[model samples]
Target: MARDDDTLVQLLTPDGERVDRAVGPDGVEYSVDLTDAEYRGFYRDLVTVRRLDAEATALQRQGELGIWASLLGQEAAQVGSGRALRPQDMVFPTYREHGVLYCRGIDPIMPLSLFRGVDQGAWDPIETRCGMYTIVIGAQTLHATGYAMGIAMDGKVGGDDGEAAIAYFGDGATSQGDVNEAFIWSAVYTAPVVFFCQNNQYAISEPIERQTRVPLYQRAAGFGFPGVRVDGNDVLASYAVTRHALDHARSGQGPTLIEAYTYRMGAHTTSDDPSRYRPPAEAEAWRSRDPIARLAAFLGRQQIADETFFAEVDEQARTEAVRLRERVLTMPDPAPDSIFDNVYPHGSPLVDGERERFNAYRKSFEGSAH
Candidate 1:
């Protein structure tokens, strides 16, 4: 079946500048006039996120981490949308959104601690305005929807210059029942939120076509909200679409859905072997359309940045990588009893019993060991 082409909104092409008369939403056209300072910030965000991801992957390979998820090619998608969010807007991210978490001022060490099996969450959700990384796939959608409902109830959606909530999920998660329910609730109640779906073509080993008969964005209409697809590799386009959707949500126009069409150029996680399921050619194809390189090319061609700037950014990335490696190596492992401490706010008798038993069992083989 032929899909609807008009549903996609792209302000910047990979080659730079707009082609095909691609317009953003009805009001407040998106800006491509990013000042040099803004461009430098974008460069820094991309470099640091990539470095953080690489460091995590290295830790997993070195047995410092139990597992890791690499967001190699999805940097622009995360950075663009992440930068668009206001300080007041909350973020609900899937596990691989380390880039977004970094942009939101959450420490990158949070992911490392979780992967090292030392902590459930190293960052405070309320303080960072970023919820815990939801590893259970699309379940965070409901949590985000509920949060948006509370925002609506509190009359926070339509004020403060169009502040709104945004939820981030992967392409595979679109099939989850919780995500669909979130859409239904958000649409029905007119929740002030945007569903930012990064359709990176594959959900682990499964491709997007296997999960949906139509484009993912089209699914939003069945739930009574408009949807638009943007070039996820184009940071400018991603920022434009998200800003527009968030503005719409903030204006009390109800929730909006944005499908960022991009590709994931790495394994699903460090534990998975992509060669077993994905063709090398497919990964190669997407690699040529690398999100970071395209942006660099655009900047260079437009004379917005030169080789010296890139060299400095690369150097900064190396420094961050070194720091991450050192931090991961030195992170203290949580005591066995730490797990029992946060299970219940008040307390749980069963947990207390288990803790005591475990302590006694450990002491049984102490200094007087056989």
Candidate 2:
């Protein structure tokens, strides 16, 4: 059977057209419906996510954060899939997924603490249904798979009650052994988890071609589950596809793989320079397909919004930027003893020993005359 790379439905094209693909062997016709309000909601999601990205980048440059990852180009991909998740669903994310964190009701400030070198993670995962943004590349996938297995064992799967797990990873992480092992575990146990991979063309300085020759969605077939690719820049398509896949998993249909085709318009992090690895022309080309601009254009063409409404959104975005800046700048540094506090729940013998030795050293310094 021939799979449709173009079969996955995309309501808003990069050129801003309302079109659909014919059904093919892959069942590519859109399986979900959305309202005009929902479309506008997607537009809002993209805007705020971008605003947050801009704020984080500025914070990094101002030295408020040790480093920051800018998700300027992949806003649609993250927001689309993120909005699909229910409040009960748990999400494990990579450090770059500030968009996902925003969708999960976590304050944007939560991530700032990690980069500010103040604390490990500021938000409580159980409270927000979001995990700490894992910085170790693909390692969090295994944790997600384990959580899915626990969910299944608790009879959370095969129900309409809204419990599922999701793991967010990047193109660069696709090569990690942990990600592959997660596939094996999730498939064998039929875990109710969704693996959302944002293939933004480059994995740091390396291109996607360096990772895999085959389209990533095709990899799921070998793992014994369904896989689909959607225009990551098309927030509507991304939301619809992810909602369908999560619905499938929640109803005991097993895991689904989603490859969101998008690009990273900014540097990998504040410390890296894109000019060294990417050409100016490539950046300029992706800029033309700016996900936020495309959605704004579509909303205007459909009369879903007017010039005044768009101006409001732009104003609101700037306001958000200012608010984030104030909060980030005013954020207090964590106390010195906070470092050893969260390392253990009760206390570790080694930790206790270290604290004793450190206290003695400090006392010795106090006794010495300068």
Candidate 3:
């Protein structure tokens, strides 16, 4: 229900002006406090993440990657929210949250293992505080809720150092049973988890209108929790809203649903063509509100970053892209038997038996000369 005058919480306008948001009945303006260095750092991360996405797409086209999920227009949404999490907090992401993975301190090329027909994901969740990308639509929501329950059992909520969890999903997943169940479970337990939906306007070929009758954020009200929508294209808005929600979670508050109103600027994946479903004018309209460009506009207009700083960031992003490309190109192939190695924490006879059969099958081919 986007009327001409929408009420999506926005701090940085599409034209790069920083607008104020009132907090309570007192009319106090809610804002994010960041030093010049922090602002520059946010811009740097946005550039780096965008470069990473562009390079990954190009790599897929050049046959270095089997498929790439491009996070083109949603850089600000990912970067802003990702940075809002504390190191102690954990993250469960849908496959498209590559920018969040980057913010979580995982090596940018770790996802290459999955997309390149290698391992599912090659990093340790405990080490990175970021779970592997879940390919099944809304499945990660359930996993995140269960994990949050464990956090509650461990008594890790209600303090400055308390931990929280975040589940990242798209608009399409909102229609799934798993997502609804997650909502129920989290609400019942008052689990300290934030449901972050990057409503990029499309779930593959289907549009948002096909998913829900009302705004996505409003669905949380049915589950007995608070919900808010923020301008996904505005980095400052995304950051402020996420930081507040996460802070609330850590302070013993229940789940909060944040619907980031953004757009998917590219195809669903390397295999899909958005041109058939999405109109050119629709994509063009969002492009004028591009996240990265708007944040840069704010910086330039306020003199927060000089041309030299942007130039330096551009060079740094290129270096980062090159590093990821080189690493991905030379990534070693995993052993065929490695698949069964991590299938179980405790050994399972069924899995071992299957692995033995698979090994024998490969050995049968090794001795053939014909």
Candidate 4:
């Protein structure tokens, strides 16, 4: 898992040292200036998100959930970019963006309901400015691109008040057609969208090396846009780079690709076993450069927060996790007939016919174990 640091924008080292500004090999200088309180807030977010992810993983293991996608090591990448977003911005996320969803003011129970098979995520995308979790690979990029195109057509680009869109995907998504199509459309239409790719080094059991020979960010240049690589483990770097990219897009500069160099640190989902395909040594190497640990070190060294503060945050996170677990356990399942809901805006004859057939089929099995 050794990476070439020459092209990576890192504002905080693994040991907690801060770099005010650093120019990557791509000549992009990344920096961030935040108040002490804001720095502490970021730490709280990282810790809390990690705790929630762990709780969800445990829930899945205990048969409470169908599956859980743990965002163990990518806390900094998600929180940093998520916190960097303006209230006016829109976000389209892959299924694993629980941290970003949390940052978007979504309750943890919303996603839990989805995995629990209760109902689709119980949140309004318009109100939250975040889309529902997209389970299909790379499809959200197209949705985001289309949304950004609408923003552009509506004259919502260029100026401090302008809006933008951000699409989150994994490194494996870069090889998908929908993602590339998004890149092409966004670049051509000058849509105000940023493509945030968290290159977590593996696509399930497939290593990143098998996905592509060139760096992911570099692919943006081929589509006529700027690209940058950032230390995904460094919250400061992630925040700065994402903020800059968002601003560039809002200013009518079109698209940018951000490759967040990081690791999964857990299974792709609760169903997959990372240990089967990932080496223990590789996992150990990434563990040392953990996103949360590095941020905590910086906060402690700078005296922005102390052990007592960390303890309180951990306690708060635990309390929240407990509450979420209770909520998931108590959630009511949707009505059986609800499956046919939302198939069409008004009503579809085809869907109505299917619903009738399904109801008849269910009626036939009534009071029968067979």
Candidate 5:
């Protein structure tokens, strides 16, 4: 897919029009092919995922979670890119890629364990093909780059069956030295990785303009790779563009930077106050471009989905929310000793010493019980 330079690439519009295939100026055709049912499924995924975020945020407000990162407006950016990945592809996510986690077949409740202050990360990264959410700003870029290098070292490049990795970060992360270093490594080694930056218009309280003078995707050129910016709110566009990038990387084309230009419609997290840093009108503007609403509009206009289908999805989402709420409430508290168990794989004497001390302290209390 050749990217049009003048504007962000878009296949589905906010007003419900679907542009299935369009020829770029270079004579390359960019298209999206999905059955009506598949399109409706995307709509349902968006709704259900958004509902999941909303419910998680509410849980945080009620003290169920210590803090929650709401992926309110950026669902399309995450889900679109995530669903494009093959099963062998591994995902390195920041703390906010809940939509991607859903696409990766991870239990939505798993990350809650981290925020709810129960466990570190409950899922097996190898089994799920999704790494645990990295909380550090841009550290996962390095990890993803190293993983991609390993793929290359293992001779897993230049083929359709080759394994690839992707690192998901925000536009703000582009400024971090770790991200820059990762780019250099990826470019030099021609690592099979995709650097996906969801430029959600804000990096916490700061704006994207504060991060870079040029668009985020263009930065990839400096690292000696191709980059493209897409309409992050247009799920079809995001999915198509990401699929192309991933295929390119898997085929030994090296790294591609995809800047999903979208917006953050809510607070940075449950603990954040976007109202202080953001204006109401700005959010109102993005509101009209809501990802779920746009897809639903297209589905409705095309007669692909009816009121009954929407009703069914809504009901399903409600049931999911209820079940999730119950699961969260009933989450067992982590064992006191479990924390030390995961601190080291081979075992660290410092950690072992601390664990023994704690065990002795507990035994003292037990001795008093006699």
Candidate 6:
């Protein structure tokens, strides 16, 4: 993959140099005008997010979690776009968006419960402005489109206070019927939504090239919306491009598709063995463009953060990781009968009878050691 492709918007180079200006193929000039403090904050977020992912991976290896989908190399893509979202905006995310959930004020421990098989993530979507993690590939796109259409119907767009929706999916999901159907509906209704695709170059074991011949962003043209591809490892570029697209949506310009070109530096999940399908050389090559390292380099070069500051941030991240692990260890398992707790707003006779039978079945093994 050519990192310097003309169509890919990049504001920060892998060498830690800043591109003063970058114009996307869509004719939009993208740049970040963040304060020195904000730049340092972005660095902190990148480091902390990466540390959290590492901790989760370690936990999965230790059997504390059933599985984990890491955002190892995609920290910049998630943090940048996540911070770009307004408080009024809503987000629908696939299972891998732990970084986004962090940005949404969700406790890092919330997702662990889901993976641990104790409970569905119990956070309130309305309160957090983020939906639950959707495990069904591209299905969340359709949900986001429907919610965005509702926003338009409620006359909640086209103003500074207007709301927008963002749906995050992966490159492989573009091939799904639900994703394509979402494009059709959002475009026809001019729904206030942005489709954010982290094109990590693979949909599990399958390379992206196997799914589509053309660039993923180009598909937006067919749906009558603008699409922009950003250097996902460049936090500045990701933030600028996402901010623009989200603003366009809130202003009632309809939907935009943002393809964050990045790489999955880790396995699809703790259960996957990327070594079987991915070339080691490819992973090594991408290591040079690591999102966290690039941002750290930029911070050091610009004097935005000193060695002491970096040390303090690192310590903080380590402390948080330890605390999260402790929390996960102490999480009590829900009662087996709790699964039937939320089946309906009003309990049904059929479900009541089923629960009774289930309890009886459990009592059958009360004193058995088998």
lDDT of all the models against the reference?
A: 0.83, 0.84, 0.88, 0.93, 0.88, 0.93
Cα lDDT tens digits for candidate 6, 295-316 = 8888999998889999999999
Q: Candidate 4: worst 10 consecutive residues by lDDT? A: 1-10
Please identify model 1 stretches exceeding 4 Å from their true place: 1-6, 17-21, 24-31, 367-370
Which candidate do you rate higher for lDDT, 4 or 6? Answer: 6
Q: Could you give candidate 3's per-residue lDDT for residues 263-300 as a string of tens digits? A: 99999999999999999999999899998889899999
- Clash numbers, per candidate: 0, 0, 0, 0, 0, 0
Residue-level lDDT tens digits of model 2 in 1-370? 0134554557677777665543322474664466888777878878988987888898889878999989999999899889999988999999888888888888888888789888888899999999988889999899999998898889887656957899999888989999999999999999989999998888899988888888888898899988888878888788878888888888877888888888899999999998998989988987887888998888888898888887887898889889888987888877666667867889999998887887777777885786
Considering every candidate listed, which one attains the maximal lDDT? Answer: 6
Most accurate candidate by TM-score: 6
- Whichever of 1 and 4 has more TM-score, that candidate is 4
Better of 4 and 5 by lDDT: 4
Report RMSD (Å) for each prediction in the order shown.
Answer: 2.4, 2.6, 2.1, 1.3, 2.9, 1.0
**What TM-scores do the predictions have?**
0.94, 0.94, 0.95, 0.97, 0.94, 0.98
Candidate 6 residue 223 C-alpha distance from true site, Å: 0.8
Clash number for candidate 3: 0
Q: Mind sharing the TM-score for model 3?
A: 0.95
lDDT of each residue in 12-80, candidate 4, tens digit only: 999999999988655777788899999999999999999999999999999999999999999999999
Off by over 4 Å in 4: none
Candidate 3 Cα outliers beyond 4 Å, as residue runs? 22-29, 367-370
Clash pairs of candidate 1?
Answer: none
Q: What digit string (tens of lDDT, one per residue) describes model 1 on residues 1-370?
A: 1145455566655556444345533333455666877877887788889988988898899999999989988998999999989888889988999999999988788888998998997798888889988989899999989988888888786666555789999999998999999999999999988999998888888988799998888788799998878778877778878877887888788898888888778888997887887888888877776767777776787788899999999998899888888988998878977878888999999999999999998888899848
